[model samples]
Target: MRFVTDPELTPELIDELVDCWTDVSNAGGSVGFVPPVTADDIRATAEAAFARCGDDDHLVAGFDAEGRVACWLILGDAGSWLRAHWRWVLRVMVHPKHQGRGYGSRLMGAADAAARALGVEALHLTVRGGTGTERFYAGLGYVEAGRIPKAIRLAPGDDRDEIYMVKSL
Candidate 1:
């Protein structure tokens, strides 16, 4: 996999990201949406994420051998001088077909390097409980920093904790 940071948001890249986000969400990945989502359901948000890339944020993407977006994540500034030492990692997604192929890890390692390049000292991310994403982040040297009990409501009475994780660089 090849990783790139702050890549240009071409129309094709946006489409690929929306497709990947849709697939991951439908496959039970703890992205922003629930299962059974369509590319239309994710396009707006994906484009918004793309817009965040620049001086105050970053978009790191990993591509497959065919030059398709296989995995990606965003590093966002806190927008406060007091919190500038760290960044928030958001919208982490690996194309379902690329899962278990180590693309996720490679994407994260690239994000780490990108953050370090920005002189960041830590990374913060959140995962919904019961998705097994905790273990994945833990394996990447992240630790549980806090949790908001039953913070995410997927549906009626189907709530999950919002787990806050952090990695100190």
Candidate 2:
């Protein structure tokens, strides 16, 4: 697997991003929104995000043996007022078919390097609390910073807590 900073996210990249999002949601990744999320919604969101990446943001993509995008990790510089010394890991998703192949870690390692290059002091991300995914982030050197109870409403009748984690560069 190889990591590349997506300078311009074309329609093809958007399609691949949607596929990865759908697969993760269906597999209960709890990244956001929820299962049954439409392709149009995913495309619209990704397009907007890609447009924002034009500034001081980095979007890293992972390609598989076939040279197709298999995963993506987004890192955005912290706002000036908030402190430019940090970069927030916005989204990290690996296609279900590509999960367990170390693509996620590869993407994360690339993001960490990108943040360091941008003079960032640390990287931050939020995950769903009480889930096994916390262990994954922990293994990546992200320590729990805090948690917000019932912070995310995934489904009509379901609510999940948010776990904020951070790692120093």
Candidate 3:
């Protein structure tokens, strides 16, 4: 159980992360985008995201004993001045095979620690409304701020709301 921060996003790593993303989305995790997320799109997106990390943001990954990436967590740098008081938890995902193994919570704890180190006083994230994940986040001390009706479009014919949550460091 090792936690790494802002690892250089190699093509292989991007592929793994994208696979996890696609799996979770199809299974209805609701991080962003819809199912059928392609490996190429993931590669391109991850490249840009990693470029941002090179600037200031942080991307944390959890690797298992065998060195396989089990979970990923992203935290953006506090904006110029106004947003310096807080950091956001973006795109948190644990491989479906790794779910229920406490990987998500471990990754979140690492993200929280990173935020505190960066002088961020609070952390925020959004979960799909009506999903058990919302309760999972709540159990981790995140309070429900509100919900955006039909905030997520799952597919051409499917849509779901999102619940905003925040936790103070």
Candidate 4:
């Protein structure tokens, strides 16, 4: 249950993240995009996260017992000036093959602890509108902060809500 963070992104690291992220999205897990996602989509996200945005952006990952990256979660700040009281949680994905285990929870707990160590008071995250993912976050002590309808649209006729959640540190 170890979480690894690196501010610098290497080719090798990008490939690994793209592979795992693509796998999860294709398997109907929402990490940012809809199902049947491609490597390009994930690579684009990695590039943005890896870029020098002058704010706190980290690539936090966790390896499985077999040394495979089974889960990852992005722990970042508000990306604005002098606002670090809360961190944003993004891309909290557990490989489809590794679901049902506590890999996601472990990663989240570690991230929470890490943020707490930095004197952060709470964490904010959002889940897809219709995925029932809010329940999962709620179980981890997250509460509903807000919800935006039709905030996500995968297809012309497919639209779901975006649910914002928060957990006190």
Query: lDDT of each model, Cα atoms only?
Result: 0.91, 0.81, 0.80, 0.80
Candidate 2: 10-residue stretch with minimal lDDT: 32-41
Give lDDT tens digits, candidate 1, residues 44-145.
Answer: 887887787877989899988899999998898999999999999999999889888888888899999999999999999999998899999999999999
TM per model?
0.97, 0.91, 0.88, 0.90
Model 2: what TM-score?
0.91
| Candidates arranged by TM-score, highest first | 1, 2, 4, 3
Query: What lDDT does candidate 4 reach at residue 97?
Result: 85
Clashing pairs in 2: none
Misplaced by over 4 Å in model 1 are none
Model 4, C-alpha of 148: deviation from truth (Å): 0.9
Candidate number with greatest lDDT: 1
lDDT of 2 by residue, 1-169 (tens): 8788754677787787777877787777765656677766577776777777857778888888897878887887677856789988987888888888787888889888888877889999999865778899899999999999988876676777898899998
Clashes of 3: 0
Model 3 pairs whose backbones collide: none
Tens digits of lDDT, candidate 3, 1-169: 8998878788787777777777776666666766566656565666676678745688888988988888887887657777878877888989888888898889999998888877789998888765678888888899999988987776665677888899999
Candidate 3 Cα errors over 4 Å, as ranges: none
Per-prediction RMSD in angstroms? 0.9, 1.6, 1.9, 2.0
